[model samples]
Target: MKFDTIIIGGGLSGMTCAAMLAKNGQKVALVTAGQSCLHFNSGSIELLGFQEGKVVERPFEGIAQLNEAHPYRKIKTEKLAVYAEEARTLLAEAGLKMKGNAEKNHFRLSPIGTTIPAWLTLEDLITLETTAELNGKKLLLANVEGFLDWPTAYLSDSLSAMGANVKTASFTTEALAFARKSPTEMRAINIAKYLDKAQNIADAAREINRLGKGFDLVLLPAVLGLAHDNVDLLRKAVETPVECVATMPPSVSGIRIENKLRGFLGQHGAVVLNSDTVNNGFFEGDKLTAITTEKLEETRLEANQYVLGTGSFLSGGLVSDYQTITEPALHLEVEAHESRTQWTSEYLFDEQPYMAFGVKTTDDFHPMKDGKAVTNLYAIGSVLSGNSGIKQATGTGVSMLTAIAVAHNILNQ
Candidate 1:
């Protein structure tokens, strides 16, 4: 099999790159093992949420100050701004309605009630430029009766402390009640699956409307739009203004993004090998000639160019042992600590070195093998070394911008 580009890993980065290339008429193939980290997303894409232990109000400015090795440094700061806008437009074109820009970081309410800086937030979710936006307003937090993921008490206390009059309510429909019979399955994704029906949505809307009277805003868990966007349906059905807040993983909002992007790729004629793993890469000289997947066995899937967005240790992009870490797919050179002891920090909240450990790349995002650049293979997203995305709060931003930048590089060539 041959393609213009083969993307390993169908996470945000791989999907973004595939979508852009496929939209431009390039034949693309994306092989994904299973679910990506999108299942843990908070309904917000963050650029640079925190820098030097402080919240960043402007992300571009924060990016400018990032260390030389951070992935954002690979894309020129000026071009990053262009790619940021392009990224937003691409996502919007892919059917994701979002707000906020790369220049300014808005605040999204976290599952535990604190505010986190975000570059783009889902349109139906509540976002604030400042905490003062909550002052003197009435807010109602509504949750499913048996859903235990959303921390309502913490959110109420946080909102009340920020000068908002907050109230809490719980409601459940027959569908939701039926799901609650299994404690382990009462997650946001499962709840969303149960609520995909019109009757269930109407029942939920009726309950919320009864409890949400006179409230300025009704806040519900982000569990209404897994298969399709039922948030809009529920919103239109209820009289009160409704918005969604994120819940614990597996996040419904994140799954919605994954599904939408995967579907968009199909619509654009991209081949998506779902639940498939790329186990070996066929390299010749300094270039990756082709690759093989577990499902496709001996059949060599060839491409002119390939993208490795297989993610970090959590997603199995990189693996570690008692002695060393390695990029499992192609045995690409990884940037990590020499000793395992230096890979972590004694303090729990302190930044850990392993989060920044990934495949070493060049200025153009090409991975290196034996200290030489692999000409046709590029590594993007959390799979790239430098920048502990968790500490820097730049995971989604890096995933998106890097992917888009690489897509441009491939298109230009």
Candidate 2:
């Protein structure tokens, strides 16, 4: 089938945009690596641009001015503000909600609170068991041995303050019977995914229920029950109203968000082609024509415009390996010091301002390849002009807003 547009990469940016475009009644196709950087993200809408430093009183307004300053800075501030508004609306329509101000408000986040607002409490068994399809559930708190995670004592305190009734039991591969197989592993990261597969919620619940007599619900890590090959069984387990709460990185809220977004898109007739196609990019003159896939072979992606939201180095959104820090799409110059060796420090929280790298975009963010638009593709998020502290605060919101602006601009075109 012919599509109106083709998107590359399936991280948060790509999938979120796919949901928005499909909802807008456009024929969109997403080409992605399926489950890319989403695994390592914080899932919180970030904008750390000014939390601990210089604050752009009118953040979006500053983005417009950046176009003149750098190739990566080519976004219109007004458009970004509008995009943020729409992104919030869509997120709520999709089941999650972010409350508060763009500059002062926090979004709903999990695994780490305060960093992101709008987080629903997974600790509240009453809320999870009652509001969610789960009740009388047993939640598993799986943590990696010796890994520093957000304080559990602090989290439990917050949960109690919120009137939640939940208990946490932590075990390393050392304690569980599985420890014999592997010394260090997450139960949810490994085991739950398998059980959620080999046995349906009912069967496994029955089997495990037999082993440990208690609540009928089993709440575990976000990656739990779905990391392995056969995952449909885990889906079957949700039959008994089993639910998984969101967790920190390596298992950010990406999967949960993706699963929910896919449902929303499907209901609206949007077809999300998983990463099964051997796809290749086709450039026609100054524009991307159609994408060629192994299955479809060749097709037309005759859209008015495109949005690029692939993230930075860690997320594979941009290239930050060695002496370079540029997006292959625009080839904008990355702001680097004398040596790539100084890219980062071993201590992640050392606050070396130089380590947070990014592209310096043109006012319109088309990327200046020899002082011209690099194929009319607009770059956003970690791929474009950004500072780690600032970006850490607003990364998710930044991607959504910019993509929305790109879509709107395309509509006008």
Superposing all C-alpha atoms, what RMSD in Å does each candidate have to the true structure? 1.3, 8.0
Question: Per-residue lDDT for 1-413 in model 1, tens only?
Answer: 99999999988999999999999999999999988899999888999999988999988888888889999999987799899999899888888999998889999998988999999988878899998998999999999998899999999999999999999989988888889899977988889888888889999999999999999999999988578788889988999899899998889888888888888998999999989998899888999999999999999999999999999988999999999999998899999999999999999999888999999999999999998999999999999999799898999999999999999999999
Q: Candidate 2: which stretches are off by over 4 Å?
A: 41-43, 48-50, 53-81, 97-103, 107-186, 189-246, 276-285, 290-303, 328-338, 345-347, 350-356, 389-391
Q: Could you tell me the TM-score of candidate 1?
A: 0.97
- Model 1 residue 191 lDDT score: 90
lDDT of each structure? 0.92, 0.50
RMSD score of candidate 1 (Å) = 1.3
Please list the residue runs of candidate 1 whose C-alpha ends up more than 4 Å from where it truly belongs after superposition.
Answer: none
300-400 per-residue lDDT for model 2 (tens digits)? 44455555665676655566556656555434556566586676677766556453566655555554444456555656665655545333345555566
TM-score per prediction, in order, is: 0.97, 0.63
Poorest lDDT segment (10 consecutive residues) of candidate 2: 121-130
Which pairs in model 1 have colliding backbones?
Answer: none
